[model samples]
Target: MSEVKNRIAVLRAEHKISQQALADAISVSRKTISTIETGRFTPSVTIALKLAIFFNVTVEEIFSLN
Candidate 1:
């Protein structure tokens, strides 16, 4: 189905934040970040909103469906 997920990875790298750092910032486990980046997990809207707020970008910029 060619689903798309986790553009947070790219943005995270651009900001030079480690997975653990982001996980801490977002109050999730580091493995959760890994799962999310790998598309094995989907975050709630609140998490998505937190991520967008952390990155200073829109939620749509962090996620998309293909």
Candidate 2:
């Protein structure tokens, strides 16, 4: 299977948001954000949608399979 990748760290940096802050906004733990950023985890559709909404971007902007 292709791996999942994300632009979360770059986007968060662009928005000047911390991991903990994004986690709080998305109702997930900071570790979840960290792992996602590091490509060590893939978020569920719900979490991905929440992150996309929080960033005011589409989920495709944050994640992809490659």
Q: Estimate each model's TM-score.
A: 0.91, 0.96
Q: CA lDDT, every prediction?
A: 0.90, 0.95
Number of residue pairs clashing in candidate 2, backbone atoms closer than 3 angstroms, sequence gap of 3 or more or interchain? 0
Query: What is the lDDT, from 0 to 100, of the residue 46 in candidate 2?
Result: 99
How would you encode candidate 2's per-residue C-alpha lDDT over 11-36 as one tens digit per residue?
99999999999999999999999999
- Which stretches in model 1 have alpha-carbon errors above 4 Å? none
Candidate 1 per-residue C-alpha lDDT over 1-66 given as tens digits, one digit per residue, 9 for 90 to 100: 877676988998899999999999999999988988999888889989999999999999999997
RMSD (CA, Å), candidate 2 to true, equals 0.6
Q: What C-alpha lDDT, on a 0 to 100 scale, does residue 15 get in candidate 2?
A: 97
- Lowest lDDT 10-mer window, candidate 2? 35-44
What's the CA RMSD of model 1 in angstroms? Answer: 1.3
Best by TM-score: 2
**Against the hidden true structure, what lDDT does model 2 obtain?**
0.95
